[model samples]
Target: MLFYRAALPLSRKTLTFVAGIIRRHRASIGSCWRKLNPGQQALLVLAHLRKGETLAELAAGFGVGVTTAWRYVNETVALLAARAPKLRRAVRDAKKAGYAYVVVDGTLIPIDRVAADRPFYSGKHKKHGMNLQVIASPGGDILWVSGALPGSVHDKKAEWIWGVLAELEAAGLVTLADKGYLGSTYAKIPYRGKNKPESQKQANKAHAKLRAPAERANAQLKNWRILRKLRCCPWRAGQLAKAIHVLQIREA
Candidate 1:
């Protein structure tokens, strides 16, 4: 797990967003009266997700049972994830905003070592993790995030498996990507062939500059330390990623 001596705080905007979600959900499906209010429940969940606080620590700090703490965190994560936009909707908004292209990238979120299954092992990172695909606007706004896939999976395969590339093509949106997606249609990948002309070299440099936003978007997501190295079940990673993505969009 990624641990820091001093905990990070969630932004006011994020708190407001979480509060609104909790309020609506409480109205729809009321939770039993408890010591923690909606605001405290939201904060407890955020502390786990953003500050990388352990379940035991959170439970002790909040004076609740460990199981109750876990329940609050997981329930809030599900609510936030439900608000995340789909790929097609995000791309349509980008098109409406007159964006020329969207950038695509993948990230490896480290997780606790699993003994039995080797599927989560990433040869590239030399760790057990999950691969998450991100699509971002040119200005560094995250547009969509794909569900978690095994880290052994390549970025291109993840894109194809999630129908991201096909959806981008069908939407007629230009995509900017790195060499990993060289053969993907409708994506402007950097020049890779040897003995390229000066023009191609310049184009490659320009491509790198344009692709920085996607990298920044990836960094922003990982700044939430729970994602820095997940200590929980691998199956829960996707839900956490989606929840964080929604909070990010709301903050933006």
Candidate 2:
């Protein structure tokens, strides 16, 4: 007879860790319990998110309609937002562990044509969808993410960068960004200048002198293919932000 290995049960150490987290923020998940079978809903939502499955794909996978899948995603997003403090705490812990410098940038995600009516802009090639701005630590862990903005909006004006600066300033941390955010007074050291190659190079060098760590961090974020390709829609932009944050935390 062939023998198969059985998976081990969750250890007490892991269970206790999760229990403690839940105990501290039980209220966040309370709404979820009243709305759906929290455990099943959470597992289904996380599975689809982790797989990067589109709404249609999720619908087909779970034998549900696309609208149902969308509803699930929306609810899950709300639940997560309710617990955003936990996410912020995770970022803070990572920063406390020697990850100080931060990188700020924006990317666009493509959406379906139906969503085009909402808000977007036409670029050289494809229609730009939503813009996702992120603030990540030098180690690439996302500290906080802002909601999506219309593609036509300037990167500097995106809520992720400008709207959150006051909170970050209160925390006493410097943020770094590209020329788009040049005029931002909140950045401890803003890097901006004319478009001339020599001028750009000089500005970069000056920025490095002020904060070399943040410059290095931005270089790493741009290395990601998704960031290189601006094609995410407003809805997917939220998922992408969560996905990136989860990945960063795991990698950190």
Candidate 3:
């Protein structure tokens, strides 16, 4: 097959940063030589995550075996994921950033069917995917991204299970979210029930105005193509999300 050149819309700083991580990881592991150097390995992983390149295509382009390509992608993803901020740290960061509030939201990262398929199916989305909880600043900056849970988990349950509510309560930050988070202990969600007083309706209108930025945050995360859908194992979804989270923070 003929090899062709391609482009990724990433800045040089992002590429250099990824290469640095690979360099340090190799030093820590005392790794031997590989089919690709740290820069090449970083490129391979970034291409896979950013462009959703297939394993066969990546392997062929990089001049390595498919297994080697897979290994590199997984290794680099784990390295980046380890750097993603945890929830508590994220909230403290928002406080330091002088933001009045943070926004909590969740999204479905669609995935291919696995052997144990039942749990990954979401009745709401009518598909198989992973649930990713994202916490963002008022300015729509991503502060944290939680590990993957099965798609079947409701948005409310997913947040609760991840201790989002408890953490926000402890932090005492004003948190904005959609109706999916209505029952949260600390987050402020829109009003429900068919018959609402004029004041509740006005409250929802104002709430929606404030929460528009959160939708942008979700779009930003999905901007990384690999997250659109996962052809890899379902278990890898969390690592993939976290990896992208780190990359996005670097990008922003």
Which pairs clash inside model 1?
none
User: For candidate 3, lDDT tens digit of each residue in 1-252?
Assistant: 998889998988888999999999999989998879999999998999999999899999989999999889988998999998988898787777888888888889999886468899988889999999988887788888888999999999998889987887787788888988766767888989999999999999999888887668888878889989888787788888888889988887
Better of 2 and 3 by lDDT: 3
1-252, model 1: which lDDT tens digit per residue?
343345446678788779778878888876668777888888889889887989898888877899989988988999999888888887788788888888989889998986556899988788889999998988888888889998889888999998887888888888999987867867889988899999999999999998996678988888889999998888788889889999887777
Poorly placed runs, candidate 2 (over 4 Å): 1-43, 63-68, 86-100, 114-119, 122-126, 159-162, 188-236, 239-252
Clashing residue pairs for model 3: none
TM-score of each: 0.92, 0.58, 0.95
TM-score for predicted model 3 compared with the true structure: 0.95
Best by the TM-score measure: 3
Q: Judging by TM-score, tell me the better candidate of 2 and 3.
A: 3
Instruction: For residues 138-246, write the lDDT of model 2, one tens digit per residue.
Output: 6554566666666777776774444655555555666666656656777644434457587667767866554545344434434433444433344656554554454
Q: Give candidate 3's error at residue 247 in angstroms.
A: 0.8
List candidate 1 segments past 4 Å from native: 1-8, 114-116
Global lDDT of each candidate:
0.85, 0.53, 0.87
